[model samples]
Target: MAHDASGGEIVAAAGTTGGKKAGFFARIVIFIRQVIAELRKVVTPTRKELLKFTAVVLGFVVIMMALVYGLDYLFSWVTTVVFGVPS
Candidate 1:
């Protein structure tokens, strides 16, 4: 662990030599290489699967909206009755 200027504990990099530091360009190149590797591993879904996922997400959102609206109406009704106001 390494401490910062404010004495907060900091985690050291794994697989590091414990003394050597990587240059800015070296770090950028490594980051780009890792991103390319990850992109190569990605498997895009088919159009039918994409449509199904979108429909499921939309249905979930609609259900959640209805649930929230129902709760809000119930709470408002209860509050109005408690406060002796017109509902």
Candidate 2:
């Protein structure tokens, strides 16, 4: 019952028995519409907040990488010391 800018008849409620099934174009339109609706509800962060979040995430990633690297090096050294060259 709905129509688009191109005057193409848009199908509605494909889930219903009498309703028409949506085609590929119709599905795309529906998906875009839903995305727009969701975006409208989103509360965007301010520039300062965005920068803070980015810095925090980057710091956490760096800390985790360092921790993993330290653990790996410690384990490798311990293994080498315990089991020397098997000649």
Candidate 3:
């Protein structure tokens, strides 16, 4: 229904009538259909792409962990110096 800056058309869910609740089997079928539709839209990465993504994520996590550890250590040291060492 809408177009993005890149000129890609966006599909919007249409609201018709206030839809009646589906029965249990009907709901399951609807769910399976939706899942298959979503799966069809998925783009899987190649092995090289997956490796690069994994490296980037791991590097980010390690950097964040080191940053947090440094801050916590600094705070603990300051607290100990100000309040004296714990008994």
Candidate 4:
């Protein structure tokens, strides 16, 4: 089975091969059909699950931002010590 870029989970549909280039409108129709098909396969989370996911994401982002800020502060302190305080 063919693998996608992120992982081996995504495999192209069977027998979906490239043929002659489609016309502009034909390509647009094909794109819309593909989008709808993918959307149909999507599984949306429940309200509670969505809230939990959002909280986890926000917490992780806050933690990461704090870490980056801490590191930046540390580097700036070190730089100031090594080069003397700027006027």
Candidate 5:
């Protein structure tokens, strides 16, 4: 067992592969185990944190939409003034 730079344990696989490649099913099992191990480390946000994040995202999106709409309106007005309102 060794420790990596990030302070995490560097785990070596138990048993030897005898210099032979793992079969397809063996590889799949290894991948699924790794996936499960990673999933176990995931942290879920609390309800308050989730709501705050959602509000922040929605507010940012609304601000961007308003900025785009204002720019579009300004461009349209300028175009109309320059082109004499398309007759």
Candidate 6:
């Protein structure tokens, strides 16, 4: 049993705890099977959906950049006022 960062209990899968270690090749096979299973679960977005998601992400990034720049400018101005401007 393992505790995650959030303190949730994580139980080990059956037959995996204190079992005889699988050989290197057997481990590789199991990894490949898990990879295939995960790949099958992936959903590819349609072209329109992809474009919309991209635009939204770009817009959000731009907005955040503007916000950070404004905050930095405000802090700089405040600092200049608190202390004499650099010569």
**In each prediction, how many residue pairs overlap at the backbone (N, C-alpha, C within less than 3 A)?**
0, 0, 0, 0, 0, 0
Model 3 TM-score, all chains together: 0.71
Task: Encode model 5's per-residue lDDT on 3-53: one tens digit a residue.
Answer: 444444434565744455557786676667666667777999999999999
lDDT of 6 by residue, 15-83 (tens): 785655656786676667666666777999999999999999999999999999999999999999999
Q: Summarize candidate 3's per-residue lDDT along 11-39 as a digit string, tens digits.
A: 33456445555567865765666566667
Candidate with more favorable, higher TM-score: 2 or 6: 6
Q: Rank the candidates by TM-score, best first.
A: 1, 6, 3, 4, 5, 2
Model 2 misplaced stretches (Cα beyond 4 Å): 1-18, 85-87
RMSD of 5: 5.9
- What clash pairs does model 6 have? none
Where model 3 places Cα greater than 4 Å from the true spot, the runs are 1-21
TM-score of each candidate? Answer: 0.74, 0.63, 0.71, 0.68, 0.66, 0.74
The lDDT for every candidate, in the order shown, is 0.75, 0.79, 0.74, 0.74, 0.74, 0.75
| Tens digit per residue, CA lDDT, model 1, 1-87 | 454454433444867777656567866765676566667779999999999999999999999999999999999999888898754
Candidate 1: residue 54 Cα off by (Å): 0.7
Query: Which candidate achieves the best lDDT against the true structure?
Result: 2
Candidate 5's TM-score reads 0.66
Q: Which should have the higher TM-score, number 5 or number 6?
A: 6
Report clash pairs, candidate 5.
Answer: none
Q: Write the residue-wise lDDT of candidate 2 on 1-87 in tens digits.
A: 676554444456546676557678878987777667667779999999999999999999999999999999999899889997568
**Number of backbone clashes in candidate 1:** 0
Error of 2 at 72 (Å): 1.2
TM-score of 1: 0.74
